[model samples]
Target chain A: MKQFTVHTGTGVPLRRGNVDTDQIIPVRFLTHSSRTGHADALFADWRDDPSFVLNRPEHRGATILVAGTEFGTGSSREYAVWALQDYGFRCVIAPRFGDIFRENALMNGLLALVLPAAVVERLWDLVEDDPRVPITVDLERLRVRCAGVDEPFSLDEEIRARLLSGLDPVMETLGHHEEISDYERRRRPTLPTTTALLDGPLPA
Target chain B: MGSTLAQKIWEAHRVRRGGADDDLIYIDLHLIHEVNSPQAFAGLQARGLTVRRPDLTIATEDHNTPTIAVDRLIQDPAARRQTELLRENCARHGIPLFRLGDPRQGIVHVIGPELGLTRPGMTIVCCDSHTTTQGAFGSLALGIGTSQVEHVLATQTLVMRRMKDMSVTVTGELAEGVTAKDLVLALIAQIGTAGGQGHVVEYRGPAIRALSMESRMTLCNMTIEAGSRAGIVAPDDTTFAYMKDRPHMPQGAAWDGEVAYWRTLRSDDDATFDRETVIDGSRLTPYVSWGTNPGQSVPIEGSVPSPADFADPQERAAAEEALTYMDLKPGTPMRDISVDTVFLGSCTNSRIEDLRAAAEVLDGRRIADGVHMIIVPGSAEVRRQAVAEELDRVFTAAGADFRAAAGCSMCAALNEDRLRPGQRAASTSNRNFEGRQGKGSRTHLVSPAVAAATAVAGRLTAPSDL
Candidate 1:
């Protein structure tokens, strides 16, 4: 995982609210084993519409996505976060995000910053006014610097630490292997082990 | 202080509490499938780690396998490769896998419960969002991403954040023609798709308790559509009876002991939740989605909502976009909406009960002209039961396709079954998101009963409408 810190980039205003995982990267794109090459399929359906802002030349090479509330609203597919990252977005600013999507984004080193809806609206306006204007998302400072507003944001402390240290949670979790084993042993012995269960025909 | 069902389960599974933010919860079971596991296995290999609890983890082929032509090779190279990777990874890791041709092969959510792997007071995690379906057994089932899947594969533990509890009390009896699908749709429509975010919703009250175990699973499955990662219903006689005689469930004395434990899994009389809401089941009609999202819904007897009805600007804008995308007009009668296809299976409503419900409605009626209906069972077990009951002949006689394909068929459109562009469907699957069924395809979420009636009427209808 890449270490997330202060980064400045052009903002692409995805002004739609309740943008779901299906819209981010359709389920068809999820067929492959490899995670790369998702950028081509990002917003696959909407990109075909000439009026969609992401298709416009002005938003090309944008690294910051300013979206409305409830971004990544449906599905727990991490491909949504991967698609955004592969499409050159290092950070996404939204008033709110679906809980699972936020976790997935953070785990992938994609910064998900929550600001007030009013602040998000301002960022969208600023980006729309000048797509070339650099927007700074500072995970270290928990603030976004853009369009003359130094907006404060909040992220879960442990997630912030994980992002800063570039630590894979699996390693941290393994530290408690003894505890996990103990719990496993303490669980009721009545439950059948996966191996003990028959893969036979259903009972009558 | 009396503990709620969720709290009791959480306490039972907690390895340790990690400050104010998170807890170290041990997962009793971890499920994986083709689409999500390949990358997780690759991640493990890259880290030079083997699976920690192969005995507790299970894999199945879903999402990418062809529902039809099970005997033939998978036609899509990408899908086939993905499925093959799952086989290779599971083989190499010594994880138990129900492969494509296996009699036990099915959707991860369906097989887990049918095999009795999902029991009361357990904590379950899977890569698929609909994993919440297992929570109906009074387990703390949650959906995790690929990264978390790798975490569980390595440690079988998740650093979880405790969710606030929201009690959704459904009062009164379900009106005639209203199914669990209708109740859930009404909940989502009432609370909006994001309403259950940051909370674990426990379905309670007389109406919820009255539902069958299969129906409870249907309700729990759609909880994710409400932005909740998990949902639960307290274990009772219904859950225990359903688990009995399953191939995986414990036998004899162990079963009695487990049942005794499960009986204690309910909320106490004075247990309080962080939030509570009441839904009148008697007032719920057969609901259906009329827009690009699940929240954009109205009763079958209702009309398309005008954007002006929304107070939020963003909501109003979304409604406008949905109207345009769905090709619907304000005040248009929802029952008058016609469909080109009727899909009667998904994790949300593909169990035997759902199949029986649809078959009951389609026993003798023929699907209307130009309207094709397909019924895909949730699992091989369900398919076997449907065939034993001769539901296939009834469906085929009524011009509905009766494919006993045991994977996600039209739900995610990762398989051979998919909707064509500009086609409209009345589907039982969750998530009516744009392009969910297929590119340019419009989906109206409905129950199996409504789906069957719609197929015969060539329009959105309920048995009551008939």
Candidate 2:
């Protein structure tokens, strides 16, 4: 995971809600290796449509995705966030996010900012009216600031700490090896014995 | 204070609490598949780590393996390499593997329950999101990332934050033609997909209690769709009966002791949760997706809702956009929607019971003209069971395509099976995102009976319509 503070770029106003991971990076794109070539695959089907906000050249290099409530609601694929990040999105501002997807994005260092529906609507309208309108998301302050509005948001504290420190939860857990080992030694006897119960009874 | 099932299980499994955020909880079962294990195994090798308890870990080739021919797997070199790597890793670590040719080879989620490996009060983790399916038996199951998989491989424990408890209670009985699939779909539609965030949901009430083990698994499988960490049903006689005489289940004297422990896994009547929602299941009809997401759904008899009715203007706009993309007219009854394809088989609804339900609906019917239908079993065992019951003949005679087994086939189009562009499909799978079935292809999530009826009618129709 990369450790870099978020600086929200121009928001791309997508009026759609419940944008699933499948649409972000279709299953076809998942067949390939998980290298850095997936930026093109981000919203592959939608990019072809002339009406899509991201398809417009005016919104090129946009870093903030302002969408409606219940954003990122399907499949628990972390690649959706990866694709958004690779496509230069710094923050996803929505009324709400799918729980697993939010966890995935936050842990992988992508910022998912949730605001009130009214506030999100304002951002959506402002960005839609002018595609070049900028929104600033300061990771340090955990706040989003647009032309007329400024409000604070909160992310899972554990996720925020992990992202800031560039620490993987698994690796961080293993850092205390001595404590884990000692606990295992102390609890060994009471722990259930392993058996190939699929094969037959345990050997006495 | 009264203990909830989650707290009881968590407390029982805790190795130690090292810090404010560090609670080392031991895991009893670790399931792995080809898609996510290679990276974790690679990470382990890089760190010179050996699997702490190889016996506790099990690996299988499911996601990437071609379902048609066991011998023809090498045709796809990339997929072949993944399976080969899984085999090599399991062999190197002395961990047991149930590969493609093995009778035990099936979807990781299906095999775990069928073989009695998933038990009450166990802590189960897998690399796949549907790991919550195991929670049906009163376990605390969840999906973790590759790095966490490697950590579990080396230490047999996971450090995790506890989740708040939320209970969704359903009373009354399911109406005829409604299955567990419909119930879960209705739940998501009502909850809007993110309603259960930051919580562990326990399914309660008489309606949930009446379901079979397979039905319970189907319900828990979609808990992730509702943004819940897991959904559990308290253990009862049905759970024990399902586990009896299975491969890994305790027997003889140990069985009595295990049952005594399992009996205590339920919540006390007075136990409290952080939040609770109640639904009357008797009123729910067969449900289907009408828009892009699972939450964007309606009962079969209801019309597509107009975006203008939305309380949030942004949400209203999104609904309008989804309506445009799906080519659905607001206020149009969902039953009037026509479909060009029908798919029956996914982790969500592809067990033996699902097949039997569809077969019952398709026994003497013929698929409508120009409408394509396909049935891909969830696992080899499910396929074998269907064939033994002659359910495949029922499907084939009904003018439906009976294909060999595969994962994510039509459910995701990850393999060769996909709808042509502009085709509308009635799918017994999860997710109906834009272009999810194929480029420009429209999808409506449905139950097997509904899929079969829609195949015969060439439109979205209820099983009773047949």
Candidate 3:
């Protein structure tokens, strides 16, 4: 996995609460076996409309996605995170995020930042007014800062660790292969000797 | 500090805490499927490692298998390769498998409970998201990745951070025509899909207690929609009774001892949760999704909301986008939305009970002229039971297409069966994600009763409309 600091890019101000994984990357795209190439698949249907933020050229290379509350709601598909990352989004600022999506995103090195609703609204308005405005998401400090915001918001500690380390449950398990092997060997029972069975047979 | 059910389960299974952000917890059961297993097995092969606990792991094919002719599966070369790879992988590792032709073969979630493999207080992991459906049996079931699948096969454990607790209490009796599907849909709409995120939800109260095993499964199956790791219903007499005499259930004295343990699974009277939501079942009506997402739903009697009416600008934008994709006019009665197709089967609502509910509605009537209706059972056993009761005949007589059993047929379009582009379908599936059924296919999540009624009316309709 590649590691890079999150910096705000050109912004697209989307004011939609309860944006779900289905809307992020529809189920039709899920059938593909390859995990890559989902950037184009992000909001495929919605991007067709000229009014969508991503479709507008002014929001190009936006690494920060400013949105309403409860972003990334619905299915636990990690592809949604992949799509967002591939689409040049490094961090998502919302009032709240769906639990599984947040986990999946952070585990895969995507930053999902949750801030107060008022702060999110302010960021959305700033971006909507001028799509050229940029925000900076400092991974080291775990803070998201924009021009209009009074104070940078801190991300959850758990999410910060996941994003910085790129550690997933599977990678964590794989890291301890030796310890697990030792435990399995020590706990396993030995088979009885053939001599012991022969002695019992002779007695019988 | 207060602990959520996820935290409790995670802590209980902890083997060790590795560095910051690395908490290793033991896993009890590892369920495998065709789509995600091949690569994991290849990883194991490259490492020159073997499956450590063959007995604790199980494999089955669900995603790519066709519903028709059991013997003709090799027709699709790509699907054939996936199935062949799974067989080869399991064989090389000495792991047991339930292949397509096997009587035990079915949707992984369905087979787990039916075979008594899903038990109380056990941690279950699979590569499929809906694996949370197994939580209905009181297990800490959730989805994992292929690398995690290999890890569980090799180590029998996983690592994770803890979660918060959430209690959803449903008091009062459900009115007639309200089902578990309706309850879950209503819950998703009220809480807005992300409500239960980072929380382990425990369903409680009089209404939950009144639900049958099938109904309970339906309720738990959609927990993923709420972004929860799992949804659990405490094991009660009803739970024990449901498991009694099953082929793999404990017998006699063992059964008694198990029941004693299960009795302690419920929350104590003084137990508290981080979050609590109460719903009066009496007020809930038959529910359906009006937009692309499960949370964008309303009661059958309600009309689509005008985007301008939304207080939140974001919400208004979402409504506008949803209306555009759904080809629905804002402020119109949701009941007026016409449907060209009706599908009544999925892990969410494809049990025998669900089939019977639809069959009862379609028994003496024919499907509307332009409506194309289909019924796909959840599993082979369900299909066998339906056939025994002649439910298939009922569906066929009503102009419905009755297909063989397959995973995510119309519910997910993982197989050959799918809606054509721009077509609208009323589905009993859990999610209504845009094109969830096919490219440009529109889905409206509904109860089995509503799906049946819609088939007859060629439009979105409630069971009462039948």
Interface DockQ of candidate 2:
0.33
Best by DockQ: 1
Go through the candidates in order and give each one's DockQ. 0.71, 0.33, 0.20
Q: Candidate 1 chain A: minimum summed lDDT over ten consecutive residues — where?
A: A195-204
lDDT by residue (A1-204, candidate 2, tens digit) is 666465857988877667777778887666543434668888888888787788888899898888767777666566677788889987788888776677667666778888988898898878877788878987778888888988898765666677677776666766777776776676424223233743654211
Query: Which pairs clash in model 2?
Result: none
Report lDDT (Cα) of residue B269, candidate 3.
66
Global local distance difference test of model 1:
0.89
Candidate 2 local lDDT, B49-110, one digit each (tens): 88888877887767766655654453456556667888999999988787776766777888
Model 2 ranges with Cα > 4 A deviation = A5-11, A55-59, A122-136, A145-149, A182-204, B16-23, B74-81
The digit string of per-residue lDDT tens for model 3 on B68-108 reads: 75665644565667788888888887666777766667788
Computed on alpha carbons, the lDDT of every model, listed in order, comes to 0.89, 0.80, 0.76
Give the higher-lDDT candidate: 1 or 2: 1
In candidate 3 chain B, where is summed lDDT lowest over 10 consecutive residues? B1-10
Question: What docking grade does candidate 3 earn?
Answer: incorrect
- TM-scores, all candidates, are 0.98, 0.91, 0.87
Error of 2 at B189 (Å): 1.8
